[model samples]
Target: MPFGGEPPQLLKQRLLYQGRRFSFESSRLRLPNEQEGEWECIRHPGGALAVPVTPEGKLILLRQYRFTVQGRLLEFPAGTVEPSEGPEETIKREIEEETGYRAHRWRKLGEYFMAPGYSDEIIYAYLAEDLELLENPPGQDIDEDIETTLMTVEEVDRAIHSGDLADAKSISAFMLARPFLK
Candidate 1:
């Protein structure tokens, strides 16, 4: 652990709701400062993302509709880490399904927490290169409304700066893969 610390003393814990991808929980605990309170959080299986690059030096992205936000967001190909699967496996499957491309080379970017205040969702990110488009690509899930898009490195940076691409994980992962980009 990098910045390790003793966890709060848990007094009681209860599961509030269990969904397909995550669960909600409430806990009563005494903090290190000796203060006691009830806290709620979301427990997730984690997520994996791939920043796929083409031989033409363009990045593959998506305009995805998220019902919660009631709009489309620009994002990289990603999926939840399923049981018994590594992060790499999750992203590998997702990249193909979402983008219709398979990557011959991969480089691990890094992992980071999405929201510490309410959820324990860590996003494992990777840089995917040497992509080959599949003739018979596996389609996306029925519920996903996604459109594949390609952009240059500068375009992505401008989108981030202009608030056009507001997805946090996408922005973070792009910054991580930036130094290696040509």
Candidate 2:
């Protein structure tokens, strides 16, 4: 039988937990190979990210703290897709809120699965150019610990090569935006 059993049938499903950004779900399934088991995954509303490029060729990034990782990681401005917002709106709002910059030109790079192994979260990535720095940037969320910075393309590549930038979503989005980076 093919993988996923031609879209596996949902035998039973339960909501394990429901959080602000995502929910945990456990599903019991019967595979094509006659295997029956329960699989747990995170059900996220999805996310949107932007690779902001300054006119002088700098990239905007954030060193944000993640409780799960217990350290700050370099990341692009991104946000979870709110129920009333699309990916574009999410990125547009997130860029200003997180990076204090607004982009007049936007080229959608692409979308990808963030962690297919345990999450159904897909991230929509965009290339944001023609940037303008907001004089009075919006205040970040009280729960967020983020510090924004600017780096050259070469600097970002170096950071990635040296594992200083370890955000998978940012790395994947950068790869998608590579052609426009130089």
Candidate 3:
């Protein structure tokens, strides 16, 4: 069967909560067994992330505080996809804002649903190279307290193994770009 059997049908949807970046929606679904139930879904506009590599074979990463986790995390430069903005535009802007580097080259690595079970958040991953430091980078957001860091591929591997790089999105983005890294 195309959908493995009779597909569940959406009967109704109601917004439970709304936030700046996401929303919670409750959906009523009719199942294959003719049972009806409700499921909560986290709706998001998704985002883009860049695994930036310098000509010197170093990777540009971010160290930022995540309030949700109540701790700092090491992550790649990333940003939410604003309405009417493409993924590439979001990543380019984010890399420059977060790392003060502009990439002359970019390659679409892949995309993944970060948390499929609860959230409809998909992230477009990109590999960025040919970087040049921006002489006058745009001012970073006041709410952001980001510290940019450069690391060799080996250093990144060590961080991954040591669990120092625990941001799931960044780890996944790095893995996607690993094959092309020097």
Maximum-lDDT candidate: 1
State the RMSD for candidate 3. 2.1
The residue-level lDDT of candidate 3 at 156 comes to 97
Give residue 72's lDDT in candidate 3 (0 to 100). 87
- By TM-score rank, best first, the candidates go 1, 3, 2
Return the TM-score for each candidate structure.
0.97, 0.94, 0.95
Query: Against the true structure, candidate 3 has what lDDT?
Result: 0.92
Best-to-worst order by lDDT is 1, 2, 3
Provide the RMSD of all predictions against the true structure, rounded to 1 decimal: 1.0, 2.4, 2.1
Q: Can you write out model 3's per-residue Cα lDDT over 1-182, one digit (the tens) per residue?
A: 02266789999999999999999999999998999999999999999999999999999988998899888899999999999899999999989888899999999999999998999999999999999999999957888889999999999999999999998998999899889998
Where does the lowest 10-residue lDDT sum fall in candidate 1?
1-10
> Runs in model 3 with CA error above 4 Å?
1-7
Which digits, one per residue and each the tens of the lDDT, describe model 2 over residues 40-65? 99999999999999999999999999
Q: After superposition, how far is residue 142 of candidate 3 from its true place, in Å?
A: 1.3
Model 3: pairs clashing at backbone N, Cα or C within 3 Å: none
Kindly give the stretch of ten consecutive residues in candidate 3 with the minimal lDDT sum.
Answer: 1-10
Candidate 1: C-alpha RMSD to true structure equals 1.0
